[model samples]
Target: MAIEHADVLRAAHLARLGIDDADATRYVGDLSRILEMVDALQGVDTEGVAPLAHPLDATQPLRADEAIEPDRREAFQACAPSVSQGYYLVPRVVE
Candidate 1:
């Protein structure tokens, strides 16, 4: 696909880029060549191949889920400056 210089300028405007006229001309040509390479890749054939996220088939070691004893809540609450109905009390921000 042939990309025009105007398209490059429009993309630069959308991206908030300030490209010099010299650079914008060069970028238009470079981007067009990149698109041609991507178009070439579309001609390749791949049959009977399973898609894979990784080349290796290894599993990570995991720890078993287990229940733990509750910690001392009363002991920790004793150090609070104010407590009401088993909850911490603070100065109200709203009326």
Candidate 2:
């Protein structure tokens, strides 16, 4: 799966990249190597291997979902400039 010069140019064009002659050659070599590696991987035998959600088999420690602060909505809303029907009112700025 060797990437050619035309393929590199086309990829660059599709990606909206401004690659010059030297960069295009470098990209072609790098992309070709990457494709070769992927091709090699496709030939590998992974029949018995189980899929893993995470690389490490460890459970994450989490804190209990309990309320740590008391409800103080009324105390906080008392400092607002205007509030009615448990809702804050603001001046109408737009139609």
Candidate 3:
């Protein structure tokens, strides 16, 4: 796929990016190369290949699911200026 100067300018305009003539020319070449590489990659045969979640075969060690801290909801709520039905109440700022 070839990336033209007009395509670069249109993309830049749509993305609200400021690109000068020199930069746009450079980007046209860069984008053309990228698209050509993508086209090349699309030609590869991988009919029997299974998708990989990770490249390396590794397992993450996980800690046991257990609570270590004591529940102190009432203790903390006692310091709040306003609390109702186990919920902190703040002054209404919106209509």
Candidate 4:
């Protein structure tokens, strides 16, 4: 799980990062420690632990999917500059 200088450079290149020699060396050490921590965590025993969708178990409230307003397409279209058969007309832009 040791991160090398080449690994750091490759990762930086893949991520589109512009890192100098000093920063790349620092990243190598940082990334190696992170991998070591992950490898250590993989050794933990959790056979009896149950997976949870959320930390808290509570139902989320939801509103009814019904409309609360009347349609006003005619009233709105009456104010438009140009409308025909309930459709707005715009000038042709493409040749």
Best by TM-score: 4
The C-alpha local distance difference test score for the whole of candidate 2 amounts to: 0.90
Residue runs of model 4 more than 4 Å from their true location after superposition: 45-95
The TM-score obtained by model 4 is 0.46
lDDT string, candidate 4, 60-91, tens digits: 79999989989899989988999988889999
Candidate 2 segments whose C-alpha is farther than 4 A from its true place: 44-95
Could you give me the TM-score of model 2 versus the true structure? 0.45
Q: Which regions of candidate 1 deviate over 4 angstroms?
A: 44-95
> Clashes in each model (backbone N, CA, C under 3 Å)?
0, 0, 0, 0
TM-score for each prediction?
0.44, 0.45, 0.46, 0.46
lDDT of 3 by residue, 1-95 (tens): 88899999999999999989999999999999999989997788979989778888997789898888898999999999999999899998797
Name the 10 consecutive residues with the lowest summed lDDT in model 1. Answer: 44-53
lDDT of 2 by residue, 9-62 (tens): 999999999999899989888999999988987787889988777988898999
Ranking by TM-score: 4, 3, 2, 1
lDDT, candidate 1, 1-95, per-residue tens: 88998999999999999998899999998999999989896677757767767778977789779877688778879999998888888998696
Where model 3 places Cα greater than 4 Å from the true spot, the runs are 45-95
Better candidate number, 1 or 4, judged by lDDT? 4
